[model samples]
Target: MTTFYILVGYLALLMGLGLLSNRFFKGTSADFFVVSRSVGSFLLLMSIFGTTMTGFAIVGSTAKSYTDGVGVYGLMASWSGLMHSAVFFAVGIKLWAVGKRYGYMTQCEYFRDRFESDRLGYVLFPILVLLVIPYLLVGVIAAGKFIQPTTAGLFPEAFPMPNLPNGNPHPLNGGIPPAVGGGVICLIVLFYVFFGGLRGAVWANTFQTIVFMGTGVIAFYMISKNLGGLKAASEAVAASDFGAERLGREGMMSKLQFLSYCFVPLSVGMFPHLFQHWLTAKSAKSFKLTVVAFPLFIMIVWVPCVLIGIWAAGYLGPLDPGQSPNSVLGRMVGQLVHSPVLTGLVGAGVLAAIMSSLDSQFMCLGTMFTNDIVMKKYGADRFTDRQKIWIARGFILFVVGATYLLAIALQDSAHVFDLGVWCFSGFAGLFPLVFASVFWKRVTLPGAYACILSTALAWGYLFYHDILAAKPAGVGDEEMLVFGMMPVAIIIAISTVSLVVVSLLTKKPSEAIIRKFFV
Candidate 1:
């Protein structure tokens, strides 16, 4: 009961912060979309870092490390820390400059102007939304899974998860149901997003970034102490059948597959939510702090989660039949923390990470729908600025509702880490197009079309096939490697090839357009 009240109090604080930020809303579409580009360097850094280090970084990393070993850090976090910073330096700064000068609020707008094809938004909008939904689900799924076990036994009779009549304890018994937990989070996020818009999101993200990172360090120290220090935890693994292999990447995954993961981090280049965050920067100089500080932040957040996961393998032993990897972090925290108030704080940190990313994604998608679809295709002159804001608000309502429903439906089949990798893969495959648009003057409208279409097709095919393909007869995750590499390698190749080939064969953009962007 104390833990539950603490969580409730923490949630109230987040909601209050989000709503309070909305009091600054300027009531214009541009203000609502990008906060009139008035953000400072420190705020910009916090907002960008907050949106990027999501549930996938915290909950998903820990969950996957339990399954695949400590190499999970190398597979995504190390590569992400390096590549994401590079992308911020090379891609993010330049986009911020162009977006500010052109009054652009979304990526689709930039692509349409770069290609001289209004219809390009029509094609690209749906594809970007499709990729982002999975990213949103990662947050929702993480929060729900994290809450369930941490709150268990507090509401034993109130929210009892199913158990055998034989009195055997189900791993999830007495935990909050995934739907109830996920729904409460979605509603809180939606309220702030709906009322405060992007400005609200940025403010909330800054608060969340501070909370999660600070609490994460505290949780790490406490959890390690509770487990008899890091040395004892490692020794536990040393004694178990898991052995020293958990310390390294050996035998858990193929070297080629692991190395090929470098391409996955490229997804940041094309994230619509990230594009909006970049556009919010007041100047190119604002990016300096973000680019410089991002890697350190990533290391601080990721190292703890991954090490805890590896340690769990040693001390916690095997998961039961009904237990999912997502439950590991929650169960471990709840069991080891012992102090109710401290346990709730740890739970809030996890939820903070999840909600920070969700706010950005929700705002970005709603802003995209309004700007690209309603304003561009439907004729913006017909609607007033107030109506435009409401349109965005209404659409945000629809998107969050649909996402929550899907998050519930897919909870059984999809886990957070793998689903996130696949989502990022789709975006990475589309990176060549964005990169060329910014750096290459010769990229043609046909090339941009080919890039977007081919990425959609390749990603759709690969994802659908992965779903339909049979897993091993035993209980293990089996992904079909394309020539012994993850599917992202092939999808990226297909997208890059089609982009370069079709551009050379097609007519280039006019000199006026080239000079507008490049010169």
Candidate 2:
């Protein structure tokens, strides 16, 4: 199959790029973790923007629009366009400056010093890992979901399906299984990250970012042409049973819920991977272009995805029973694009978006585990720089494998948009702690501890009771509320209240501790 061959070629090119980047690796911990803090304006822009546009932007948005209609765009992308840049300007710049000055490598490292407590790093490490897995899962699962539909018939005998009663071939006649697709993609990401470290991830991200954004435009134009144009497609959907649902934001998503998504975008402020990217900036000025241009990049990728998904809602009608909305993007493209070459390019584009985020996430976790956990726990003075790099590589390998298996296990049940939103909510709920730690001069160690423990405990309870258990009693998620507000909104309140109340009532950090961080 030309599509399969082209897809393989794309994979090989990525591997070559990763190996090539290793040539520049300095073989030191600082260079591996943060590119020796020498990255410039353009690379910083590409990597930061690329890492943010995960499967959530491409696969999640398209699938969500397919189900929730054009309003899906309003939920995350519109808010993210405004909020993400605001966070980058307000929060990212400040973190980068402090991290550069203090020689910090991870968010937990910053916390450990900010509070003058090793116990804080120990407390925050597991929580950070837990939140990151779900977000990483979004990218891995999306890789599998997108690959299957476009690569159908490439392995029909190996992953065969039964024909219809009328003897017609099955819709998924032959496709790469989700498990296999996810595994292969994860392995490829691991290859580059293991060799290039953060530098490799950044370089790979720049290349993949360019590919996905450019091909996104091409796919949009070709698909619109295939559909007889967006205007004609809209008119057709408006005439269908799904018309009102596809065209408006009223039915499935309420005004309160729509507005509450603004809180979710605030999660970007707490992203560990994003923090790592911020520290890679050569100077504070490096962030200027990213803040100004991020919203436009969001528009470029998201507009095409949401528009295509709106068209697919009418074009595909009701999906077959048991089918996930994740299939909508590939199925729509495969059916409409028609050319194998074009189909391959779309597949490559989807994988590029997925992997761009994955590399950064994998690298960040490894860097954190090594810096905050391994070095501090064992003794930074004991190991050479090379050993530290190897330790990071080993941890990255373990996490990647764990995540790949988890993604495969949940492939059938997890919804892309739902999983991503939940992950972001956890990070968003903890944003108050991060914001206060950076800006609020009176924040205390006791207050920071209370904030993290309370927010995490509440987040876990709400996720289980409000979301997972809600289905048993016939309560739909969109209609569900906690005291007349979304669960995430409540989580933020708890985070803020716990920090302020506890800090006032508890012992304050010494003047020395305050002087170290504040000054």
Each prediction's RMSD over C-alphas, in Å, is 2.0, 2.2
**What's the lDDT of the predicted structure labeled candidate 1?**
0.86
Q: For residues 10-91, write the lDDT of model 2, one tens digit per residue.
A: 9999999889989999888999999999999899999998898876677668888989888878887888889999999988
What TM-score does model 2 achieve against the real structure?
Answer: 0.94
TM for candidate 1 is: 0.95
lDDT of 1 by residue, 266-373 (tens): 999999999999998888888889888888899899899888888888878888886767766766776787778777887888888899899999999999999999
In the predicted model 2, the residue pairs found to clash are 153-174
Which regions in candidate 2 have their CA more than 4 angstroms from the true location?
162-169, 239-241, 414-419, 467-470, 476-480
lDDT of 2: 0.86
Clashes of each: 0, 1
